[model samples]
Target: MVNSVPDCDFTADYLTATEADNLLAHCLTALPWQQEDILLFGRTVAQPRLQVWMGEPDAVYRYSGTDFVPVPWDAQIRALCTRLARDCGTRFNSVLCNLYQHGQHSMGWHADDEPELGPEPVIASLSLGHARRFVLRPRAKGNPDRHEWSLGHGDLLVMRGQTQQHWLHGIPKTRRAVGPRVNLTFRRLLGAEVSAGRAESAEIDVG
Candidate 1:
């Protein structure tokens, strides 16, 4: 079941409609959503969507050359993490929350291949609210392989094994009118440590 797509797993209905609706509403108001500045092509630009990092205190994540300290876990998110750990068979310790306010709020192509994730990281992504298109392509140039999915409410997509080592994924900006959506990606950091120095730029994105 976990190998539905070459190191990826897609569960169409991980959460019931009622559960998704309630979770989405809670996240919209309960979580502290904020736009962050990211380094891109030698320039600092605001990330297109609002995001919050939540997890254990030691799970400091570095993305797009920025080190983010995890916020204290809320009861709701902790419960969800427990459920995902059991169901996905991975002890996830952190979650990145992304809020896409509309069609214009999108993520660019990037791999979740940070050093803290270790080799062959397992990432479980749960989607709620409006449906959106997710695209994946091989990192190797000129590769013809590509995959796409319409991740709607209650869907759970898990990427594990060597997926991050070989593929880049993103949510492209859409012109069609769309409502708000939330995505929670749960992961386990391997010996995460806080760093003193900061870099200027690197490829990073949330999905």
Candidate 2:
């Protein structure tokens, strides 16, 4: 229902409030969340939020100068991926789980343009817990095309086609008192074999 952007879809209530609340409670205590250090501005620093990368065995992903070996998929997440495949019409082999403990935890502007994701990747983002602002802007400098949405609990946002190639998106840190939020971005990693060496270095701000 997001008409202002191309190759993007939004559903404000993807799941019933009860279902979302239950899932949020389970994820908060179940997922193995970790705060990893990432290279930013040529310096190593801890990521602002906690995260866990989960996927099929071969779905290794590399970003922000680090190679992440996929953790085995959790039962809840695997079931969600199956549902997303049916609903979004794309198969997802991997998922990046981000946990924002509060308003201060956030993601910075970056595109999911890594080579392993392929040229036109389909990204299905599911939100749980507190609502937060998600923004997108044209990657080209000063084009003035921008879009934002209040992604609340159980909302689903799908970004596909040329969205990553032409635009950059992120959730900025907010000063308001907000509760914890969890964002799951499901994706399909291409390539029959994982690359041996690092891809070209690019700064990534992930939550």
Q: What is the C-alpha lDDT profile of model 1 across 35-119, one tens digit per residue?
A: 9887676678899999999999999966665778889997988999999999999899999999999998998888887778877
Worst 10 residues of 1 by lDDT: 194-203
Q: What C-alpha lDDT does candidate 1 achieve relative to the native structure? A: 0.86
- In terms of lDDT, the poorest run of 10 residues in model 2 is 195-204
Q: How close is candidate 1 to the true structure, as a TM-score?
A: 0.91
Candidate 2's residue-wise lDDT over 45-104, tens digit each?
888899999999988865666778888999988998999999999899999999999988
Name the lDDT value of residue 48 in candidate 1: 92
Sequence-dependent TM-score of model 2: 0.91
Q: Model 2 has how many clashing residue pairs?
A: 0
TM-score of every candidate relative to the true structure? 0.91, 0.91
Clashes per model (N, Cα, C within 3 A): 0, 0
